[model samples]
Target: MTAASFTAGLRSALRQRFRTLALLPRLLHSFWQTSPALSAAIIVLRLLRAAQPPLVLFIGKLIVDEIILQTASPAPGPTLADWVESGRLSAVAGWLLLEFLLVATANALARIGAFVERVLTERHDNALGVALIQQVASLDLRDIEASSAQDRLQRARTQRFMGNQLLTSLLSQAQDFVSLILFVIGLLSYAPLLIVLLLLALLPTLAGEAHFNAKGYGLNVSVTPERRQMDYIQIVGSVAESAKEMKLFGLGAYLAGRFAELADKVHRGNRDLAARRTLWGSLFGAIASLAYYAAYAVIAWRALKGELGIGDLTFLAGSLLRLNGLFERLILGLTQITSQTQYLDDFFSFMDLRSTMVAPSNPRPFPVPMRQGIVFDKVGFRYPGKGAWALRDLSFSIPVGETLALVGENGAGKTTIVKLLTRLYEPDEGRILVDGIDIRDIDIAELQHQVGAIFQDFVRYHMTAAENIGIGRVGCLSDRPRVIEAAQKSLAHPLIETLPEGYEQMLGRVFARGLDLSGGEWQKIAIARAYFRDAAILILDEPTAALDARAEAEIFERFRNLSEAKTALLISHRFATVRMADRILVLENGAILESGSHEELIALHGRYAELFALQAAGFQ
Candidate 1:
């Protein structure tokens, strides 16, 4: 309502208009790529449909003129049969038949065009969906995890649903535009001033539509975060994953009330816009209608003065009436397009995003038998939007075939180290070297392929037991023998064998025939994935936190044997698991406080010994 705000909104709308205009070509290119034949077919069909209205109207005029000419005949036939018998009414009959044919053809064209457009829109939707997924996948881990990036992704996803509809609207408007041009030519030949009057009458309507459309877009952008929250609440309230907790805690009513509050806010915003649009729309419509009648009055008076034929009067009247409606339609359609283009802007902008992480153009291959070891040299990192560092001045190394255990409490930079090793987050300062070469020199994919990791919060995939393990080495998903071997190593084979379908049985409760596993059982399945990888460097970050003492001991024994020839990193709070490592690292606040064998640390009575004693006391 303020002058400053209005001016700002106008500028924003103008910018959006220009940006969307730039995106139009890209949209057309996407449509063509989806299916060139279908795209061309739709355009040709619309063009044919556009030409039909003008031709049909012209034929109707001819039919009227023929009837009037026959009616004025001096020796007219007295009966219908007599008229048919004589050749006097042949011209009228011919015009009538031509008009019938044109009408039939127009109907057929309309039906076919609708069918073609439907098919095209469906194909385009599918194409856009695939592209969206691929684009998301190509983004960096940092971008995917950031809150701002998620908002952009949500907007992009919502826009995909509108893409097909926007396509249809654009093509339909193009059809209408062609018809409008033809109608304008028809009017210009007779009364050009009527066209001017119609345009003037609809100016206010056009302005109102543009302003409201811009306001609607702004409202949508502002409510995106709330809309995302509503979606999350809906999922939590409806899905099976949260059902048990929701029932036990009686959160159902709370969630429902929260959702309603957000929904009402959104509803009020939309309702206000709709009410304003309706009021202005009706008033503008009345003015347009009044202008149409005024134009008709001029034509009627001219006909009465014998300046124009009865047929001319009829043709001009019909054309003017159609032209009036056409002008209104064109204005409204153009505004709809300008509004829809904002969504197009969201989608194409998403597509334009490029990841910042880049690999060497000529990268070194991964070392199969890594020579020296892995080293982190004075590495420092801080998470986005955080002032405090997650890891700082962290320097450590694991020699070839050595099992290093990292002992750290929560927020002690244990998981952050793993994330850094996997190149999920780039260090603010320092270098990670594998085999004495900077990891940046090696291809990222190749580096990752050599390091296999299983964290505490591992994924419980809703797939078969074999697939859950096999996903770790996707190329070997069909290698049943390898999958079984990995499962056996992690003590998961016995658990899976007891299931109804064994390896083929689905895991997790997301599907109809799925069987959910307990926390300990899921941990075993997750550990199986790291074994399945068979990489040179293995990382187990509290992977057995869910297991019992006996189970944990059994799993670690097997891991020790399998990793005898492989360099590995182990992170666990349990001293029982930590004692087996070749070297123990006592980390506090992102820096190593002490390093030694378990016996040596126990002798020193440092942070490690103190933590070990505290854990040992719990068991006593």
Candidate 2:
């Protein structure tokens, strides 16, 4: 290859491998801003730790030299009387004290480094966790639902905790490498051969560690399915909604068996890998031990032959031990970093996901209170990877100050209509207009702010009663009076009143002092959440499914009163609720079959009438 081409290829490879490293500056900037004092302390402690090792090695060599001179024959060396008279004993004792001081200083600095790193890591973890959750919240609804996007999100959540540890470990390793180099250079001046022997000893351990790390990462990657299955089992076995069915249907044991099978598969794979690693480690360990003893024999022979002093032998042995520890730590740290790079890849991939539905560069402002109604003009949409359209060339308008109901069986695209109207999904074929302006032109945040929706399977948050309702308007999540008012509006206040702590009562059994709510009560809480939003456009999808007849009727009546002069869309299978809507649109096979008031639809005797009669028969 040409020199330029080779250089370009190398650069590209590095960019691919170390893309997350490129983001380190930004990550460090955030850390500095969040905890400047802790960051400074870490840097100072690391520098101190780097400086202390060479000082200790220098003091060690001095002590060794002093002992050698003192033990030498009386011809050139000072006699015991001369040594005492010259205060040489006190001088040696002072040197030993200084050496001890240096050792103590090194240990203290290391402890300080650890403490600072721990504090910074915890702070970074909390900040990143909150940031990720907020990013997920801010994402467009359709983007959040995309399978690839969700996969990235899951990966990010998994790596977030470990990412902080990886960062701190990298910093510590860098500092330790500096210390190791200085210590080795100091030892080289005393015994060069010992350095060579120490290096040889480290090679086998380094090789074993590298292999172990690679195997561990491979095992993690291969067991993704087993891990996901185990997680699914845990959720099904623990969640309140699934608990009843799990027991009644006798699915608990079945799920437990599946979980055990997956666990066994993972355990066996890990055990096999560990056994191989152990074998490699043992073989290398034997070689390393032999090399060390050979080096020891050479030092002892040199000392006996008067080629080296006894104190020099002691210094050589001590340096060899320290070198072993230093090299092992260096190799282990490098392997840890290599393995953690995969986690960093996953974390950055989530943060960098590209959205299909991009916001406009210059979005139009959404007028407050939505003076006009919403219109769908030749709207069509297809989910990603689907061959057919969920909604095709459909046109409809919901006028202001009116209640519109969409009645359809499953898979008739009723929910899709609400999703598009709320701008959760953009139409591929045509435009949806809000106040006569294309929704694409409006600010996404503003558009979402004007809408409130309750899905068929709404989330049952494991939080306090007030938080469950207040989260609907997250910006005002602590507004107690507003939460209470919303709860009252949805007839959930009575349920809250029965709780021991009223609004402060925990709503799920996941935490201490938590109480589980019945399905009907949870429905009321969800309804209150929608009510708390107080948006201009409201959508309810099977919101009354869990309510008793009396409660359902009362809620519908309250909804009717609350929705007066407001634009609302209701999706329900209950004929009684559909009858209250000013107009009903009957959908079949992804197309509108009929649209009229209840009486008009009954007169036509179309799909709407047929479905209505079928439901009415249930009541009879």
**Which residue runs of candidate 2 sit more than 4 Å off their true CA positions?**
1-30, 73-86, 146-150, 188-212, 281-307
Name the best candidate (by lDDT).
Answer: 1
**lDDT of model 1, residue 340:** 88
Report lDDT per candidate: 0.88, 0.81
Q: For residues 217-282, write the lDDT of model 2, one tens digit per residue.
A: 668867765786788799989887787798899998899899999999999999988897788778
Residue pairs with colliding backbones in model 2 are: none
In model 1, which residue pairs have backbone atoms overlapping below 3 Å? none
Error of 1 at 586 (Å): 2.4
- lDDT (tens digit, per residue) of candidate 1 on 1-620: 56686567667766666667677777888889989998999899899889878777877888888888877886556788888888877888888888888889889988998898888888888988999999997777888888888888999998987778878888878898898788788768789998899889987677667777899988998888889999999999998889999999999999999999999999999999999889878987898899989999999999999987877888888888888888888888877888888877777888889877777889998787987889999999998899998888889899989999999889988888888888877888898998888888888788889888999889999999999999999999999999999999999999999999999999998887899999999999999999999999999999899999999999999999999889999999889999999998888888898999999999999888888889889889
At residue 582, give the lDDT of candidate 2: 89
